[model samples]
Target: MTRDANRPLRICMISYRSNPHCGGQGVYVRNLARALTDLGHHVEVVAGPPDPLLDSAAKLTMLDCLDLYNAENPFRTPTVRELKNPINLLEWLSISTMGYPEPETFGYRAYSHLKNRVHEFDIIHDNQSLSYGLWALSRLVPTVATIHHPITRDRQIAVRSVRSFWKKVKHLRWYSFIGMQKRVVRRLPKFITVSEFSKTDIHAEFDVPAERFHVVPNGINTELFYPLPHIEREPNRLIVTNSADQPLKGLYYLLQAVHAISKQREIRLTVIGTPKEGGGIEKLVKKLDLGHIIDFTGRVSNEEFREHYAKASIAVVPSVYEGFGLPVGEAMASGIPVISTTGGALPEVAGDAAMMVPPENPEALAEAICELLDNPEKAKELGEAGYKRVQEQFTWKNAAEQTVAAYREAIRDHRKI
Candidate 1:
């Protein structure tokens, strides 16, 4: 059956595991589902453990899977009953061997669940879960996969960050799912991605032609991220949203810059993520005597996060690479002056509104933050520019419209075949 362009489409969004606090993927699933439903689409998110939080407009169907990597229990063993299933056995073995088995297992579960209900939805949209099961589903339903960016690039960077031979082996093993992803990617015809940079990077890394990618940028939550003009912005308070120990986040360089600045002036840094105990960030903080000047808020509520940004003088996106820089857009939407590294798609998101710093350069970050702090007028100007840019360019409504167009196209193509 062909889709009616004028009518709302039924969409099944598949996310293997979505934890709002864990990363941007969860945020993407939650917000996009809400946006799509608001557009009058029948949206159902079929997700795994740490299931995403969604708007009341969208229906959520939670798929049970052994959540071995839950923060409370990392690599915990499953019960014999849970392991009775072949899929669960694979998950257990993969995690025991240091491989992330969620994607593969999630695919099996999602496919089994959705396979019988294929005719119930107009299309199946896979969110970065490029598994063989998705390929199987595509043969039955019009499948569109959004590869945020090639996981191979992430694996390469992760391996490069480690030095030990055994540790390198561990990194390689952990990211072994990339091999499965590559094969699954080749089989899908329709694709959606967040940015132009991601479209090109994903094509190059995954060898999927750029022509197949529909570039629908992710939107910033304007309601949650807008500037609070009533609140006085702190001159010495700098904030960054980063997963402290991740090598790709470039937090080490930011910490270095913070340490250097603290020596000359009484500046404080608020990290939105926790530093692993005795990890790289914690060690550097103690070594630089910056423990007194720094604070990690760990996981914060939306209200607290907005309040944190409202109190900051500068918001930094120190990531070395991003599929789409959520922090850049969020900071801009919050009306904060942003200093971002020209890594991956960051420049695409920041545009000319942000001070572009070279990735991994602490000196440049330090100088830029200091310059903005010293000239409040310049910082204010940039903040206003960023906010205006986001209003004009990045909104969830626009993204949802584009996504629906892509879905319609996929349905049309499926009918042709």
Candidate 2:
């Protein structure tokens, strides 16, 4: 088909926080916007807090909200000098006492600026902010939202894992924003989710009709995550990546499994994220007496991360819940066999290419690891299959094409109203 002579579509992608070091949403916004720009669309990412690592082709509009959630000092108190402004004080107090993540509050600030200049874009694509501001935007412009998955699942799993009833209460309080999210999602005209698993789960959890949801799988940056042909994998070496000390990640089970595996086999586990000096995960490592065999790499650059993936014999994703499992796909893209639990969409992401285990089951995880280690040929076959699967199904180009089509659909739907 020939290109349309009309000017390219202008798209504004919004995310409250897009720090690449922290989580998946940053990577989603960064890559999707770049891919859309490559497809001859004008893309601008309006974000709060840490900046997104965006391509030069895509413009970035930073909406500063004090960035209290940066990983370096996630909840550090602002100085009195910094909080002389009443609004800053309110933001700090609201987040500290109420436990609501600051993104929604920040989104309101971003939306205020964006609404005055809304004419610059043909569509507004929100990366799961689900704030009241987003609801307002739907009233003014062609708007669509990507609800990665229901946050309610995370709260449920986290609460279940906590032994203390008070801790569970705290978890519930922290995730109180879920009520707001469900309300916003139920009323939204169009919603985008990364996988069919997430699509169904969101519909069931948020009580939204399935027809209103659009399935758009996330893409992988194959160039950065490709296999290292020259690096030979060391035996009994494993890798897992997650934000440090997050209970929902199910790293505790993986740690237990690694300890069990080490009792029989000489094994080493490399955690791609840092653990606090005396945090729960670190304490667990010490208590289990497996500190000698486990290592935390803190934060590494993209190149170093790929090298870590290359050197590992296997990649384990033991998350209890994931809206989409990027590490599983990235490891697969790196031609490493994955041992992932059937947490949320992990089975959907891994499919038949990688081994699957039930979540929070160290015995099952250990058994799968032993099977892979004992049969190197099987592991190698799985790795190759995974690489092929990722190449065939997950790529930025595919995601971009589908996203553009979704944008068009959203625009057409908006026109009808």
Candidate 3:
């Protein structure tokens, strides 16, 4: 199977669910696949949809599933005809019982798809679908997985966020897939993650050997996030990308900060995401009576992102934890002065270009926001600095080169085994 080092490597990048608009997973898949292809590698993305929206250079293979979590009709019971396939039946039954089964089911689907064609690629790069089927795939090909961060942290935070016993039980049941991830990841020979913090934490939680992990920071998509000079920056206007109800995103604290600041001055906060109807965040905004000052821009397109940044005086990331903090990098790339909390790997992404606050502290977020608003010169300077940092250090080209090194290492190790 040895090939010339100068030749392009055939890479199959797999993801169970990939929607670029949803979360970091889709974003990661899209950017990484494009970058790798740009590096003269033959790249293909094997994904379960809502489309990944990949660049035309990279090939895309759509893997179908029941898609029970589709937003239009979430958790809908699948038709009996759809469940005729054993895999589809397993997926429906698992979700019906309050268990998340996408990762495991997708792994099975991927294995079934690729088992007969193992020689089509030099390596299989899994985007955290750490499932039993992945282990089986590893035996057939050189497989490496990227564990963005341990979902164990998610489970811990979710369990702690709820008060009722049954509610907590439901959360535990939903996150039961994490147990499968833990079992599968440890068996893989090589792993990739975004930050040292993530690598350390995942090793501690998943008990994977530290040497097995490779740390590669995510790249900013500058094409979508660069500053718009033609657009005027509005004063006392702030923006944040919100996962409104998730305790992990810390939008609740940001709402409080906005409420406190509004008492003394004219301030407006534009959230680049929608809150769930009558969700905790929506309720919090109503309770604080901050609707006048806060505007949630539901479902922003990629083209509209920079304009939102251009109009904002400052951007804030109030995350309780992050594996890499893509929003911080996006803000930095957009040349917006940023105030970010010292959450997991946020400081790593932000470096010294942002104002750092203690996570989950509304008062600190308020103070930092106010500081930037009161001093336009300082805010502008920080924005320029952040833009410079991203340009010099966070290009997808750099990430792609590092990732190829890890891929080669995995290939060599696989051959030896």
Candidate 4:
């Protein structure tokens, strides 16, 4: 497919799991597709498993795969109908017995379906499904994959933190997909990442040249995330958005900080994602007698999420690492003062607009939260500055423009080959 400077480009975005509630990948797929469509391009998102909440402007093609690990029921037995397909049954058996991530296997299913209609799109953009199938598809189309960040970091952190030696072994076994991802990522023609921090990490981890990577910042939907005029902000209330049960999110640290803060001052915590009813976080909440002070609103809709941001006096992002902390940008866009840890690309995204602390330091987190809570004027000033920062720096329009340029560059480079 040749890029014509005057004509609109047809683009297909592929993702293995695009559940908005799952994590950043779904959010990225939805917002980027909308932004590309807004730019007068034809955008089709082909995804698997959980449904993606996409913009109406973009066309959505559902490519269902055996979603063996849905969050609602992490590991449930497939029905007879789901097991009727021999490939699906084999994939399920492999995952059940060996503990390997299935996104690549599923991506193969999606690729096979899309490859038959390869001529339908000018470019194929993948959302972190760095599978062998993607390499196969790249030969037939101008393909570019977005590697959010190196999954190796996630595996290392998870393994090192496991309390039991057996559990650590299991962690390594589960994350064995990293081997496949590393090979797939290195062989890709071009890569798009959300931040320079991630780009550097990707190059180091996958041994890809710096020239093969493009840094395109992810966007926040300011329209949906903006502050609510009617909602009253709560005093001394703190909010953090994460898959709270996930250790990599650093929710445990935030919980420790909240416990420390509650001892000195009256504070309330509202967690956006759900925690296991009898999990570590729930145990901590009980141990600290934080039932009255802490509340978890599990898997809220977009409007409700915005209301939580609006009601909170401040937002805290306690991630151990992020490719680009979407919550930080989302909080900033919602006109909320942010207190983030200096983990990964957070400082790059927050800049001077947010108060930064070191990750896993409950004391530092408590101090920062206290400082903001004690001084309303400072908090309000920080909130306004953050809003302006997001407005100027991280918008979907900017991301799409940079991405389109990268696509054009990839096409030019491919032609020379």
Candidate 5:
């Protein structure tokens, strides 16, 4: 069959610093773009430095920016050549002053590139890069942003988690970009969030009305997370994919629970991530004396992720609050029983298939882990149920279709205005 050039809608997805390793935002972008293309739409991603990986069918336009926070050499001072450009200087100055400038700078860079080719795209989809540049683009084109969750939630968690005034101040500085995001969210005609919890949080935190928001839960990449049943599961092992460096992830609580569980029974924990050297989590593991039984695999490839799931008896997501718990969906898809807290959108994603406990409760977590460990039959039932639920409800194809609906709605709303 011959391809029809005019059949597919041209899309421009803007993301300001998508690090695939750091979090789900990058995963969301990569998987969503590929799924959208699979639906016959032409997606062209305009991403900032450290670009997102996309499907071969989708084109990626790497928008150059000062990648000061590049994980390899985070907080590195800009070179003399980098300072010659005003935008680069602005980015460097902001970072030097303990501020985040990527969203604003990336938005400016996107606008600079898109202004000349604005007509080429059917609509612009901003991936939470709330900057003045994106606001400018909204004026000229139909624009909608996907704010996964309000950043204010993260900041609130961080501030409350720490006692040190200086550390709180540092947390505030790193997340100072919320100012830009909130301002931009207030002005944008339409934006989407991944869950009802996030929609309510964004409205309360940013004072954006519920009317401007759309709820589209993220999808799990089933292909990467499905079961490898040939690999034997460990009988007394627990696995959790944690944001090891952040308190909001509740890794400390999980660690405490694991310590308690280990004392009663010889159980091991496999953490599918590495904690930063000298970070709070690393210190806590030592403090709790959990080094021997706990294993932090740092970052792992997709094959490794599935392999880890295959070897684990159960999966846990101990986040205090999640915009949407990708780990829960991924674990479910991997045919692993999940034990998650009733935090944020975890319940929304986990539904009734997995065991639930309260957030920030080590006692509740240990009870759940122990109960499942003691009953192999119950664990297997939960695992099969979780896998069935994910197969029926969550997949990238579904997310892309729902997202496209929002995009078209945004376009229609823009023309009406």
Candidate 6:
């Protein structure tokens, strides 16, 4: 049956795991689902463990998973009853052997659940789960997989970050799922990504032609991340959103800059994430005597996020690579001046609204931070520009419309076959 272009489409948005508190994938799922539903399209979110918070207008279908990798209890063994299902058994075996199996296993689960109900929805939208089951689904119904960016970059950076031979081997083994993703993505025809940089990078890494990819930029939720006019911005106070110990986040460089600046003047740095106890970040803080200057707010609510941004003089995105650079957009939407690294798609998101610095360079970061702090007028100017940029360029309504176009294209492609 062909889709009616004038009528509202029924969409099955599938995500293997979605935790609404953090991570770009979960954030993407929540906002995009709401946006599509707001456009009068029927959106039903089918997700796994650690539920995603969605708008009341959107329906949610929860899927069961062992959730062995939950941060609270990492790698917990499942009971015999839980493992009775072959799919669960496979997931356990894969993780026990140091391989990430969520994509492949979740694909099987999604396929099992949706096989008989294929006609219930007009299309299936897979959020970066390029599993073999997604390929199977495309054969039955139109499928659009959003490859945020190639996971190959993560694997490469992770493998190189470690020193020991055994550590490098472990990283490689853990990311073995990339092999399946690469094969699965190459077979699929329709794709959606967040940026031009991601589209080109995915094409080179996944070997999917650029023409097959649709670039639909993610929208910043202004209601959740707008400037708090009542709160007074602090001076010589800096804030950054990052996972403290992740090598790809470039937090080490930001800390180095903070330490250097603290020696010359009194400055406070608030990190919107926690560091592992006895981790490298904790040790560095002790060695540099920066414990007094730096503060880490583990996980924060939306209100806390705005409060943090409202109190800060500047917001920094020190990531080495980001497919869409949500932090940059969020900071901009909050009406804060941003200093971002020239990594992956950061420049595409910042777009002259932010001060661009070279990635992994502490000196450049330090200079830029000092420049913004020293000139409040300049910082204010940038902040206004960024807010205007977000209003004019980024919105969930726009993203939802572009995504529908991509869905129609996928349907057309599937019908031709």
Which regions in candidate 2 have their CA more than 4 angstroms from the true location? Answer: 1-7, 72-76, 79-89
Which lDDT tens digits does candidate 6 get at residues 1-417?
A: 444776899999999988787778998999999999999999998888778989648899988889997888989989999999999999999899888899899898898889888898889999988988888988899999998888898888878887999989988998898999999998888899999999999999988888998999999999899999899998888999885576778888899999889878879999998888998788888889998988899999889989999999999998888899889999999999999999999998899999999988999999999998999898998999999999999898999999999998888778888
Tens-digit lDDT track for model 2 on 131-244?
888888888889989988888888888788779989888888889878778888877898889999999899899999998877989999897799988998888999998746
* TM-score: model 5 vs. ground truth: 0.96
Q: Highest lDDT: give the candidate number.
A: 3
What shift in Å separates residue 395 of candidate 3 from its native position after superposition? 0.8
* TM values, all candidates: 0.97, 0.95, 0.97, 0.95, 0.96, 0.97
Model 6 scores a C-alpha lDDT of 0.90
Clashing pairs in 5: 274-298
> Which residue pairs collide in model 4, if any?
none
Tens-digit lDDT string for candidate 4 (1-417): 434764788898899888776589998888888888989999998888788978659888887656667766867888889988766886787688666756667678777788898899888898988888888898888889999999888987888777999988888888888888888887889989999999998889889999999999998888778978699999999998874666678988888898888888899999897788788778877887878988888889888999999999999999998989999999999999999999989999999999999987899999999999989999989999999999999999999999998887777676777
Per-residue alpha-carbon lDDT of model 1 for 162-198, expressed as tens digits?
A: 7899989998999999999999998898999998988
Please give the range of 10 consecutive residues that has the lowest summed lDDT in model 5: 1-10
Steric collisions counted per model: 0, 0, 0, 0, 1, 0
- Residue 247 Cα positional deviation in candidate 2, in Å, after optimal superposition: 2.1
Pairs in clash, predicted candidate 3: none
In candidate 3, stretches whose alpha carbon ends up further than 4 angstroms from where it belongs are 1-3
lDDT score, residue 172, model 1? 95
lDDT of 3: 0.91
State residue 167's C-alpha deviation in candidate 3, in Å. Answer: 1.6
Q: How does candidate 1 score on lDDT?
A: 0.89
Error of 1 at 28 (Å): 0.7
